[model samples]
Target chain A: MNSTAVTGHEAATHESEPGFYGTSWQKLMMWWFIIGDAILFGSFLAAYGFSRISAVNWPDRTQMFSLNFITVMTFTLITSSATMATAVAASRRGDRKAAFNFTMATAVGGLAFLGMQAYEWYHLIHNGARMDTNPWGAPAFGAYFFAITGFHGSHVASGVLILLITAWNAKRGKSGPEGVELTGLYWHFVDLVWVFVFGCFYLI
Target chain B: MSDTHAAHVEASYRSYWIAWAILLVLTLVMISISTKAFLIGGILLKSVIIGAWFMHLKHERAILIWSVVAGILFAGFLFLVIHFDAGTSLL
Candidate 1:
């Protein structure tokens, strides 16, 4: 398929648009990027798993993680994903205000998640479990803790920034499917990656 | 091509919302089961669902699919090579 045929809403003709699977070209590119990212992060988690298998002892996530706060944070993020999808739908219907509200809600969800993550880290570090401490007696555990979660957190921050920009542009009536869809793609990827991260780190 | 394409896009929007809701619920369930070995499986499975539905990977072009598969395979090769040689090779 010719990607050049895909275009944002304002393109001259829908047939000339480069979108695939009903999405804009930029959204497709973002998915391609996510696939590559999955590989990068997947390798890290695989290494962690291998190391954990080889190690004698591992810490309990139930003991290590504050589940109550994390649950709330997770709820916020899940809600954000819902809001983002709503925004996408609204944008398609030409409801700019609703779309902007949902995007802003998604951003707020991202920020709330980050704030909770910060609090979790503060408590965890204060309790002496760190990459150096190895309080759980598995150095790989500590390494994975800092590496995966830290990297995911950085992505969340950047995704929030992108959402903010998208919201602003949408409000100004200058937003294109390229930007909104790309942000949606990234936001969805972030949520997808978190599923694995949460499973490997917090849950499993 | 035009008429069929429009129909397909319309169908996709319906599926998209359904998929999104399924994903959201599944994610929460996976997280709720935190600390279970199944959590990892749940996440992996849920990711595929979201990728296919929300990210529309299932609808992506062949080039996109091949490139990602090739890249992951190459990275896996690198990992295997490094791990196999880590014992005897000097850093």
Candidate 2:
């Protein structure tokens, strides 16, 4: 019933070390990783922005992408992030059943998003999109699109795998609440990156 | 569980759903509008909501929050500087 004893990892950290900013070392390390990942995406987007501005005939996004379909993909990721948050909360409250269920739900959502992304890629490639060339206006368009979205998709794929493992561990009472929270952080970071990608690449 | 603790849990759950609703609304609005400025603003707002609410940054200490915010802003600044150079090179 100790409020500070929400997770085994956290309790252990509190007893031994004050911890940087009073957060578990594991959580702090995760944040650092997220920051580094953010920089990676930021650099990619920056390069994309340069290509967009420098290009004489940038491809028309409206013609290349189906806005409605992209919106659905966005919805899936956001909903999955919400479910991840719920899982973390449930785990913290000692409701392992709910936590496991929500974690599984989040993994399902991630799978759905990846499936949609694959379809989108297939649709584009079928229409002559490739790394070197495309039916689009700029040759760099194909390269940037593939690089950015492909990297993001890879992150989602890995996140789904991690979620499945987390759920399995939770069901077996092997992982603690901190594990759920850490995974949730990573999941939300993926969604966060998509917000930028959707806005910078698709909307704008 | 005590009544107060139960109520707290309920409120926390409700907040997550509320964040989700706001995110959906923002996405719809972003797509409906074609203005670049509005889209950028919407993306930034959505990022803040996701970080603060869903990621529980609001519950973290000031030092951690500032570290994250500062790190991202510095990266963005670096991007802008590099972009300016790229622009000049083309000119």
Candidate 3:
């Protein structure tokens, strides 16, 4: 890692003067953001779990959540993470066009995931699910469900916009490789958080 | 200045594909474990895959990686402290 920011040419070298604990300042900041975000998501999940484990008669997941829809959404997000990872690798390899394309595909994946979420939400709302209400007698169920998934959906929305911007800059050759890489990190963190959310909310 | 990653991480599209495949398999395992005790295990496996491969945390600086570990611990701490306030199933 050189003191200079990574450019298209330097990205090919894959050599680094680890700026801050093996990454650039921007990259470090992204990780810090993720850490903070993780804490918040963690607390919400914990609250949901506590509500769940203590239930006398909880609505079973099969009845409350649409497994097929959520499973597809999970795949879409995971595929996006793969694309984001590929984009980072491409940028590191100095293939800006390939990197830009991969990132674009990642943004598409985010859009696809959001589309699925919207469809699911519309269907659930039609079935009488709301922030504070649900068909299930346990009103707390709807509250936590929407709270957790809604929060996650918001992150995915932000991620899509960030990816779009990163993709646009990569196309224009305006953003440095480090910038692309940091954005990629943020994208993956969103997916990472969703992993647990899926497990806690949908599976278990 | 020290690079946290091995100079030769062999970062490539091939690796990304491999990670994606692993994730899909883990998802399958998780969904199947849906109501089982291993559901939590499946979740942890998925997270490890994403953090190590997708986030490239495996090649990141020790401090960065440890920061993630610290974050997980902090989350665990949060749960432990908050569980008392949540309702109980004990009859």
Candidate 4:
């Protein structure tokens, strides 16, 4: 056999093979996960679109939702995504301190977003929004609003927890640059989903 | 690290901030414009910026990039079909 040829024993001993996508396995797996999550969000938003189109008395989104508040939420998420990118970059450059700090900042941004979303939900529920019915023109409006935004909010909550853990591990040198990069990928994906949600549900 | 590498890192950092600025500007423009077409376009642009810069999809291989793009296109196809069906059913 050629020297470069892998024997069964050598292949068995190998821990990792080369990534098929020219990236690390961790990153490739993260991308696949993000794609799957994207489809989930896409399906939710598509259903929302169908409901809105079919409803005869769809509530006026402009009246129901505060655009200014949504803008702030958008700003928070986008800023957090920027911080996450910085954290990934810092980790790549071996600046663990910067990575930890930026990851913490991202977590803070996510918390702030969740807090604001909670307030929005509180206000809506107080104003008579429920799963089966709502003060809005169409009952499906409340259901879709709750389902889509609540699912996205849950993701933000999860991202915040992951960021906190990532920051802690990064500070102690437990997780490496790939971990931060993967977390950043998930965080950006959350922000991407919001971009579509904000447009389809709020603006359009 | 070499000076060239440091320069590249700095450039990458600069690109991230540039993308952030563009995203903010696009978002503000979207809020200002009430037109649906413009809003959809702005959202798409923002998604592109985030995917390319923050997620580093732009630096990835074409195969990886196409995989993502294909997923999004599939979602779009699904939406189109649902939208059409919903519209026709109501008519």
Q: What's the TM-score of each model vs. the native? A: 0.78, 0.91, 0.88, 0.91
lDDT string, candidate 4, A1-204, tens digits: 311111112222342544768776556777888888898888988888888888899988877788899899999999999999998889878898999999999999999999999999998898888987887799898888999999999999988988988888778776677777878888999999999998988888
DockQ of candidate 2 against the true complex? 0.64
Clashing pairs in 1: A5-A16, A5-A17, A5-A18, A6-A17, A6-A18, A6-A19, A7-A18, A203-B34, A203-B35
User: What DockQ does each prediction reach against the true complex?
Assistant: 0.27, 0.64, 0.59, 0.74
Candidate 2 stretches with Cα past 4 Å from truth are A1-17, B1-8, B86-91
On DockQ, who's better, 3 or 4? Answer: 4
Give the share of true interchain contacts found in each model: 0.35, 0.65, 0.72, 0.76
Expressed as tens digits, the lDDT of each residue in B1-91 for candidate 4 is 3467677677889899889999998888888888877887788888899999899898788999999999887887778887876764422
Looking at candidate 1, what is the lDDT of residue A106?
94
- Write the number of the candidate with greater lDDT, choosing between 2 and 4: 2
Name the 10 consecutive residues with the lowest summed lDDT in model 4 chain B.
B82-91
Model 3, B1-91: lDDT tens digits are 1273334435456787898999998898777765555877787778888888878798788889999889987986887776776555322
Query: How well does candidate 1 match the true structure in TM-score terms?
Result: 0.78
C-alpha lDDT (0 to 100) for residue B80 of candidate 2: 78
- By lDDT, the candidates rank as 2, 4, 3, 1
Tens digits of per-residue lDDT for model 3, A75-139: 99999999898888776666789889999999999999999988988888898987776777667
List model 1 lDDT by residue over A1-204, tens digit each.
212212233322332366544445555555667777878887886677656555667777777887667767766776687678767666655678987998999999999999989988898888887885657566667678888899999999988888887888777766754556667778887887777677667666
